[model samples]
Target: MSTYKLRQGRTMKSPLVNLAVRRLAIALVTLLIVAFAIFFATQMLPGDVAEILLGQAATPEAVAGLRQAMHLDQPAFLRFIYWLGNLFTGDLGTSYVNNMPIAELIGGRLMNSLKLAGVTALISVPIALTLGITAAIMRGTFYDRLVSILTISVISVPEFMVATMAVIVFAVYLGWLPALSMANEVTSITGLLKAFAMPVITLSFVISAQMIRMTRAAVIETLDTPYIEMALLKGASRSRMVIRHALPNALGPIVNAVALSLSYLLGGVIIVETIFNYPGIAKLMLDAVATRDLPLIQACAMIFCLAYLLLITIADLVAIVSNPRLR
Candidate 1:
């Protein structure tokens, strides 16, 4: 009997390891594809980097010399191979406009974006889960309907519009927070939080709306399960029943929903960041595009894609661990 249990443990462990290895392999392959796509897209972008750098009135000979100097004369395939080799060796190449290394350009901006997402998640997740669970517990009541209506209403508004409205109300009308996040650099904790206030709220409201709906659905389904019904019949207090049974059962799906929202935050904050002039990966990508900075653009795009893949992979692992059935 002990041997059988040991064998069962080994079998279960093997699959989990295999799952993790498979996910890692997929992530690597997807990153390669993203690299290729970003490179090609940048190559195809209109306007010549050399000309843009040298100006329109520059002689054709000067332009040709600059192009050759930048190795822009090389075929697209060769350039991609060279770039890919450098990427694997930890060199992200240099910008065409300023000649600054891509790594240095993106380092701080990426951290700023991460900080923004973190603050937004901290504010959003608990409230969203509470509202969702409350709605589920009061599933057929007026409170449930009210929560449903509120979340749906928030979801209906586009992020940029929501951001605009928040700036108008909180910055212009209320004079509480800064309208622009450009100078909201994080020198100190208080300054950081104050600078992040409007952007965090704007992002949280939009992100939390989807989470609220998903959490409500997940918890409601869990509540209807046999275990929950049995707990109720055993006269388990309402709070205890939900806290111990329903919430645990519902946690897997809630985590997945939050992960999905986090992935969105990582890559989908372009408009919000742009509107507020916030320094972040999305904003850096925008600047790269505007300047036709091929190397910088590719680096930022690859980073965003990798972040998204990582988040989903983490969500899958968490779900498997939280739900024994997945094992």
Candidate 2:
């Protein structure tokens, strides 16, 4: 019997590890596809930065020199093969604008983007879960209706509109927080809180608003499951029944929603980051767009795609752990 139990344990562990490996493989393939897409899309985009920099009045000799210098004269197929080789070797290329290594430029900034994304998720997920659960538990109560209406209202508004209104109400009028910049102006934690208050809250509300709907749906579904009824019949404490039983079951869809929201956040809440001048990834990508820096644009897009892939992969792993049916 002991040997049989040991074999069962190993069998269970094997499948989980196998699932993780499969998810990772899918993520890698997704990133490769993103790189290919970015390359072709950027190539097709009109306007040669080389010509723009050198001007149309420049001689053919100058044009040729610039093309050779930038490797534009290379055949498109050869360039893609070279690009793919470098990507596999972990080279994203130098930034056209800064002449800095792609890795170096993104390394520090990605952390800041991670910071904002992390904090935003931290703030949003709990509130969404709580409201959703409460709405489910209460069912037809006034509070449930109110929460549903409020979340719907928030979901109806765009992030940019929310950011603009937050800036106007909190920063422009109430003076509760600074309208722009998460820079070194905040020397203390309190100062930072005061500065981040509007930006964080605005993004959180916008994100959580949608999450509330997803959470409500998940929890409602969990409540309807036969196991929940069995738990109640067995006289399980309400708190334990809800927290230990229903909560875990409800978490799968909630996890998926959070992963999707993180993908959205990584694009950098254009309005929120812009309003606060946060200098996160989205704003950086926008700057890349305006300047037409092909390498930077491609690198940034690839980063977002890879980040989204990672988020979804994590969500899938979590779902698998929480619900054994997936295995």
Off by over 4 Å in 2: 182-185
lDDT per residue for candidate 2 within 6-85, as digits (tens), equals: 99889878877887888889888888777788889989878887776677898888988988998999998799889889
Pick the TM-score winner.
1
Residue-level lDDT for 282 in candidate 1: 93
Candidate 1 lDDT tens digits, 47-141: 99989989999999999999999899999999999999998999998987778888888888888898888889889999988898899999989
* Model 1 lDDT, residue 9, Cα: 90
TM-score of 1: 0.92
lDDT of each: 0.86, 0.81
How far does residue 14 in candidate 2 sit from its true spot (Å)?
4.5
lDDT of prediction 1: 0.86
TM-score result, candidate 2:
0.91
Model 1 RMSD, rounded to 1 decimal? 2.0
Residue pairs in steric clash, candidate 1?
A: none
Q: 284 in model 2: Cα distance from truth in Å? A: 1.6
Per-candidate TM-score against the hidden true structure: 0.92, 0.91
